[model samples]
Structures are given as C-alpha cells and as structure tokens.
Target chain A: MSSTTLDPSRRGAHAGTGGAPAGGMSGTSTGPGPSFFRVLNSEFIKFRTLLSTLILLGCTVLVVVGFGALSAWGTGQFAEAAATDPQAAAAFAAQGGDLAVGVPTSGIAFAQLILGSLGVLLMSSEFTTGMARSTFAAVPKRIPAYAAKLLVVMVTAFVLTAASVYLAGLMALPILDNYNLNLDLASPQSVKMLLVNSLYVAAVAAIGMALGSLIRNSAGGIMSLVGLFFVAPIAFQLIPGDFFVEARKYLPGNTVEPMTAVQHVPDTLEAWQAAMVLGAWVVIPVVLAAVLLKKRDV
Target chain B: MIEARGLTKVYGDKTAVAGVNFTVEAGRVTGFLGPNGAGKSTTMRMIMGLDRPTSGTVTVNGSPFARHAAPLRDVGALLDAKAVHTSRSAYNHLLAMAATHSIPKKRVHDVIEMTGLADVAKKKVGGFSLGMGQRLGIAAALLGDPQTVILDEPVNGLDPEGVVWVRNLVKYLASEGRTVFLSSHLMSEMAVTADHLIVIGRGRIIADAPIQDIITGKGQIRTRVRTDQPDRLMHLLAGDGVSVELQENELLEVTGLDPRRIARAALDSHVMIYELTPLQASLEEAYMELTKDEVEYHSLITTGAAAPVQSGGN
Candidate 1:
C-alpha cells in the first residue's frame, strides 16, 4: 500500500507502508507555515504526555469538589446558628447572607494557585530540561509556539475550572439539602460566579506562563507567580499607605471581585475596568516574556 | 551544502567561535574535531539558528536556516543529547517534534526502530540510560529525513554496538547525498567515520582539509629502513626538514620522506636494504599536534585541577 504519489512533486521509492516517501513530503507549500493550528497540536502533545501534568490536572478537580462539599456543610451550620442566635443573625446580615452563590467556587483561590503552578511548570520545564532546542528548532517563528502554548494553558484552565466548579455545585446540592438550605444552580448570581472564577483562573494560568518564560527556572518562575498573585496583595495591605492601597487594585487576584459583582460594589473597580485590568495583567507580562524569548538564545 | 562566512559568536567578553569560513559539501561525513571549549557546539547552534551570531552568517543550501521554508527538512541537529523533556516518554518526545512538521506517526515509529529505541520507546526519558538517551536524540534528528544532519558527539555514551550502528547510519546517509556533519574528540572514531575533517581550536579553525590530507599534512608518514649501511642510507636520504632516527642496530625511522625515495636512494647507492617498512601516523598523535598551542593539551602532571585525560595513546 505504498507509493500512491498524491503530488507528482514527491515521487520516489517509498520508505514506509504509505505513499509518502521517507523524504518525500517537504515543508508545507505556503500560507502560515507554523500556523497556530499546527503549533497548538504540537503543544497539546507536549502537554498531555507528561505524568506531572496529568497529576496536576487530577489535583485541580479533586480540590475544587472537595472544597465545595466542605463549604456547603459549613454554610448549612452557619444558617442553623443564625436562626437560634440574634447576634449571629446580625453578623450574617452585615456580611450579606448571600454566601451560597460563592460556595461552588470556594476553592477557586487554591485552584488558581495549583493550576497557575502547572502553567509555570509546563513552560519552565521545557527550558530547565533542555526541551526548548527541539521546540524552537521546529518553530523558528518563536512567537507562534508561545502563543499556541498560552492558548493551550488558558483554554485548559478555563474548561477544567469551569467543569469542576459545575460538578462541585451539583455535589453541594445534595449536601446542602440535608440542612433544608436552598441553592439554585440556575440562579443568575451562581452562574456569574462560576464563569467569572473560571475566567479568573485561566488568566492566572496565563500570567504563570509569562513568568515561566521570563524566568526559565521552574522554582524561580513559580515563586514569581506566587509572589505576584499571592504575596503582593497581602504585602501591600500590611504596608500602610495610600499608594499601596491604590496599587492593590492593579494586582491580578483583586480584579476577580470587581468583575463578578451583581451591582457596582464600592471601593472596587467597575466591571469593565476590572476586565481591562485583568486583561492587562495577562497581556503585559506575556508580551514582554515572548519578546525576550524570541531575542535570547535557547 | 552548508556554508559559513565569518561565522562568529561572542558570549560577553569571551568569544566562543571566531570569524571563520568553511563549506561542507554534500555526500560526505565532515568530522568537526576539537577539544572541550573549542566552539564546536556553539558553531553548530549558530548554524541551526538557535544562537544568533555576533557577526557574519551561515547558510544551509543557499539560505539562512531560519529563512528556510522548512528548516527541519533542510537541516536536522542534535546539539545535545539532554535536549529533551525528561518527563515525557521517548515515543512522545519524537511525536511532539514530528507533529510540528506534520510528519506522520509511521515515520516516528520507523525512526524509533532505526535508532534501536523500539523497546524503551514507551518508557519515560528520565529513567533512560545514557545510551538510550542518545538513541532518542538521534531518532528525533532523523524524524524529518533531513538533507543536512548535524550530530554533536553522537556516540558520546553509546555501547559499542550502538556506536557501530550510528557510524554505519551516518556513512550510509552521506552516501545518499545528504550532508552529515558530526563532532567528536575521539580521533580514532573520526579517522574511520569522516571523509573530510574540519579541525577547530579555541574558537578558531585549525585545519579544513580532507581526512587523508589532514592525516598526511599534520601527521607524518614515515618509513622504517633496515640496512647494514644505515649511516650512509640515513645521510643519503637526509634533506631539509627530514629527520632519521635510529631505532635499533640496523633499523632507521625516516620522516619528511616516503618509501619510494628511500628505495630509489638505496638502489642508486647500492646499499643492502633488508626491509623498507612504512609507518602510518595514528590520528590521535596528529590531532594532538594540530591543536598543540591552539588548544592546551596538558602534560600529565599530578597537580590535578582537572586531570589531563590521556586518550587512546595512553
């Protein structure tokens, strides 16, 4: 079943069971050589093959669901206490007893940390393990490979986070029902929370990738990512100043609340403003990293 | 064909490869010979477009490697055997590389088989022995069936059988009109595998000549002449740049002259010559001579900042 000769350009004694000779099919004819599609395919293969990647993916799902069930039981107990105690009821009112909407995404902060670390590991491992030479060799148009990897990471983060959130919501329904608590999965606020948190996790993953590219060492990249999303906000708060207070708005983790609100929340960015700020958080570092990666030797 | 015009690389204050020019014609194995820090890998990296040159340019088949429509098809390079993700299986590593050029899975399998990695193809590369890792690197290089192949120390950690396989494979590839350029410090390996030699030292090319020419030019081909009239024969054969060393009572080792001249001198003078034996120079000694001052061939002093390796000649 060899030597069918699809294009007359590559006619020779075939080297395999198919028509394509060993050296028959050369480079693609024209139009987007290392196209996004091709690079994406390559990146996907790289992503799925590693045991560490699969382990991280599995951890993301388990944490989201496990935390969701825990939050559900905790919320039910709090609701029961509010009924018996007046002071507890007042505190619950002050906090706005709308805690159910966020229960499904209770583990999102942890999810972001884990999934973001996965993103950092993926890109940094390539350099630390010396895989960049093979990667860059295939796609010398370096940006395409970077873009494809970013696309893969962000999309995986979005899909996995969203699905896990939904599954967590479903699991919580049964647990919350035991305490006669009502949780509407179809509620507008609930849907908004799931979508916004998923998008937030995806953006965090992209930022992680940018850090990995900028710093090719895995420990350095993950530490930088954690420093940006985890440490910076707390550090800013601990330092008492108007500048630190104002600068905290620009931090990537804080943007999720402003963009996910039911109404324009005071002392927080507007929805559109938060969206733009989050976009900048992902784009600015990613672009800088990409430019440096292209210019520097592997 | 691969051509470099003043291909240079400088890392901060130290230059790894200086401005030098050479062309590797197709259909032969060009052995890049040098000691460590001789810029063989740096030059190969620049040629593959992984490292940008500080000055000058190199082209494969009349265009810079990055500019080629399909760079992998034009040239394949294994700069380092560690140039792989350890977490991935050997099969998947090749598969990921193959996917970039739309190379099929069948070709990947064929390359795996060709490199004798079929057994460990499914295992994680992190767990592989050094020999297995080298096979995987070779497999990745051959995935595209490239015209110009560059393998840096391809046999560095191979078993003897694996070494023979690679030697035969590169020679076979060269015979089919592909340009196969490889680098090694083993002069014995280079002597047999290369048709041409490009010797580099301290970021500069020392000699660029055919294999035979290098062995002849830098290496002396001497003759052992056994005769009762050794002194007369030695005097008769003596000329400018020629040296005659008496090994035994009757044996004389003649340099800067060949067997034909010695036979002619003996016939003309009517000296009774019992034996005229030609002694071929080993490539190891020749390589040492070629890189004498250009690269430090350290003496066997026990001071040992780094032990000076006495290769096969030891």
Candidate 2:
C-alpha cells in the first residue's frame, strides 16, 4: 500500500482555500452532479453486480424453455389421442385448435414468480446490507435513484421475458411439427401473447420492487408478492362469494389471462379494464414506495 | 466548513440529537468526541442529509448537503463502515458510487490504492474482515476528494498502522485547507489528532473548545505532596476551594492549588517538604469529568471478590 500522503498536484483548485472567504465553498463544485441518466447508470451497475441476481435471471430462462418443450410434447400426444377416441376429440374441439401457440408461454407462472422475487431482492437487499446510505448520499434527492432502479427492473424484466418466450417458441417448433401442428410465431395472436405476457411479468417485477422498498425485507417482500399473486387467487376462488369472484378478475395475476386471451372470455374483465387494473396495481405501490423512501431516514 | 444550527432528531418519543449548534471550520481537524449513544452518529447523519432534522438545519459549506450541485465533490462522508452491499466486490461498489458523480476510473483506482485495498478490491465485501471493511469505507469517503470530509469512528476496527495512517490522512486533508470532521469515542485518539474538540453527551453539546483547553478546562489543578508533617501541611492548606486529601500516611493530594503556592505555604509554615509534583489532567479524566452525569448506562464497579451479605430475604 502507498503512503497516506496525497499528491499535491492532483489536489483540485479547491485546495489552498484558506485565504478564501469563510463558508464560500458551497457552489465550488464544478464537477457533474447526479443527473437522472447518471443515476440510472449507477442503478444499472448495482443491478448487474450481484451474482444471485444473475442466477435468478438465468433460472427464469431455463424454466421458461424447459416448460415450453414439455408443453409441446404433451399437446402433440393429446392431438394424436383425439383421432382415436370420441371423448378426446370433444376435448380437443373445446381447446380452440391452437394449443401449440400457447406452448411457449406455458411457463409464465414460474417466470413471474422468479422475476418478481428478483425484483424484491434487489431493493430489499439495499436496506438489508446498508447500501442505501451510500446510494442516497450520492444522490440525495433520492427519487431519481428509486426511479432509476424501477426502470432498470421493469425494462430488464420485460426484455428478458420477451426474449426467453421467443426462444422457447423456437425450441418448441420441431417438437410441435412432429404432430403436424401448425404454430406460426409471427402470427398476430402469438405476438400479442408474447408482448402481453412480457408486459405482465414486467409489471409483476415492478410490484415486487415496490413491496421490497415498502417492506425492506427480502423474505417479507417475496412472501407478500406470493400471497398477492398465488394464494389470493386460490382463496378468492374457494370462498364462493360474488365479491371474491368479482375481485378475482381484478387481481394482477388474473388480469394477464383476460388481456392475453384470443377473445373476451365470459365472466372475465374486458382487456381495457384488466389493463387499467394491472396499471393501478403497479402505480399505487410504486408511488407509495417512492414517497416513503424519500421521506424516511436511510 | 460545516455548520449546524439548532439541529434536532426525534425517533418516535426519544430525541436522538437534541437542539445543538456548532460550526466545523476549514483548515483543521475537528474531533467530535462523545460516548456511544451520545448523538454523534445522529448529528453526522443530519449533516449528510441522510436523516432530516426535526426542527433545525445543518449545512455543508453554505447550503444543505442535498442542495449541492455535486455533493460528492463538495463533501464526502463515511457514515457507517457497512454502508455498502456486502455481496458486491469493493471495486464495483466504489465504481457504482463513482459513476453517480461522473468520477473517472483513474480516481477510483487512486482511492483504492490509497486506502490499501488494492489487494482485495476485487474480493466480495461479505467475506472481508472488519478492518478491511473500514479500509473500503475510507476508500469510498476519499473517492470524491471532497472539500469537506466527515468520518464517524474511522479507526474503530483498524490496526495500529491503519490508525496512524488515518490520523495522518485527516491531518493532511486539513493541511490542504479542507474541512475534516471526525468522530471518536476514544479521548486518547482525539487528544493526539484533533485540533479542536466538540464533546457531546446525552444528545447535548457539553463542551466545545480547542483540544488543549478541553484537556485543562474542567479539571482542577492537582499537586501531589509528600511531607514529614502531613497533618501540619494539611492544616496549613485548608482554605476556600482548596482540598487536601491524605491518601496515605505522609502523602497528600492537594486540589485547587498550584505547586508553587503549596511550597510557599510550606516554607512560610516552617514545614519540610520532600516531594511536590504538579499533576496535569489527561484528556481522559477531563472527558470523564465533563460527561460523568451524562453517561446513560453506567457499568457497575466491582470492588473485589468479597460478596455482600443481604439483610433481608426475598
């Protein structure tokens, strides 16, 4: 290690300020401050630096592709069974004859779970590991950092999910071709499903980040996300009440189905209503988290 | 220069930092000395704008820390040693912080080498020892080469060499006309390092003055005298504000009187005195005298191995 003495030449113009007016150093900084884009770069650096975060992202891709291949094989077997049994033929007719198109996105459930937990961990670990102090100390306005982190989480989630789903579709092509099933990935319905599912996963990841910020604990944030997306839907179904049945349609997880459906299924929300409800789910928690994060001590 | 005016912080019902005012001037090392839980960390947090003051303001240079165009360039602080993500490597942690202010990569490498973390800069912080963590914290604090530097217990977990390095570093920063505000509970460290001292206790500023003044201000001048006629000397030294305690058979500790006065009195009284040594109070005693009443938790003094018998049974 070098000696602690600083090189005098490297000492900026602020050095030798003993003759300067007392308390006149306020606006002396000529260096760049934390602009939004700079803070966004910082947040991106933080997001990609963790090994655990990268592992979780890799797991999301693996689960999506693995489920896609399995779903394609299962759909081929069912299509072949439909030719032999009248009962199987009736079930096949009920399934819209385009089962292969949905095969790529069959792992949307697991993708949401993994990516959402990742979102929670990213924000929660900041507080848990005491990194918020350094983070806010750099950009004291604080909201920029929050917004930057949110943008990073959402954009990464959307892009990763989209790419993974498309890759899964490519992988499923040969398997589906064995059953003579025509699955066109470039079809409008397939594109809609990919785009909507990617956006849904992005929204869920954002909600997870909001929960992480609000709760500031990894386990608590992930549990609350799971409860909102998984348990609440099942509980609402088993309760057997009109309010819960109605409430189930507005659940953030439930909205993905209505918005991604080929047609407006009976007793489900319209695409616009489900879109609005999902938007509310993301906006309310995000705004609350940002405001509280700004107001609270690091 | 960092200035705090009527700064206060209340957590729920307890006030962590009560209304206090002090200015840390440039070109000197100002030591913030206090016992644990005496509001040193809370006050520093207020100055950093990490914690909002309940009813007052603290400004770095001339404005609040958050209002600076480039806060890192104007002021750098080591609020906590662990104020970093443990899972990240030290280099990446500093890289992320440096990116916020557009600090160049060369400066990041400079701070790393300066702080003796070049060997472990790529290692994950979670596996680092406390000393390594402290070194990393100091590296981050100096990353900005700020005009004002605030470090809370910078040498808490450092080795002797590291401690000496920090001492010289702060002094060097001050020599270049930068403001260096350091906090430590160790009065001995403050005595050797700080040019000025601001002593706080129980969320209050108990003393603020030059380091030498604090060492000799609150404590009385004591003279240890050994004489053949202890009783006579004690009798002769009895006066207003003068106390003479007979520590042993012929040794007497005289307080509130200088050695010259005691010798004069002994010479005039015709009493022989062999030894008279004037005792200068150390900063540790001075600090204990200042914060004696303000210590929140007092450790019980164990006199000996003998147990006291209880008079009443429960």
Candidate with the greatest lDDT versus the true structure: 2
Global CA lDDT computed for model 1: 0.83
- Runs of candidate 1 with Cα error greater than 4 angstroms are A1-33, B218-286, B289-314
The DockQ leader among the candidates is: 2
Tell me the DockQ of each model, to 2 decimals: 0.25, 0.40
Per-residue lDDT of B207-264 in model 2, one digit per residue for the tens?
A: 7888876666433678899999999999999999889999999999998887889999
Instruction: State the C-alpha lDDT per candidate.
Output: 0.83, 0.88
Which lDDT tens digits does candidate 1 get at residues B95-214? 888788777788888888888888999998999888888888888887777767899999988998989998998887776666789998666688789999998878888878789876
Q: What is the Cα-based lDDT of residue A219 in candidate 1?
A: 98
Question: What are the candidates' C-alpha RMSDs?
Answer: 6.4, 6.6
Clashing pairs in 1: none
Q: Per-residue lDDT for B144 in model 1?
A: 75
Which residue runs of candidate 2 sit more than 4 Å off their true CA positions? A1-6, A10-21, B218-286, B289-314
Query: Would you estimate the TM-scores of all the predictions?
Result: 0.85, 0.87
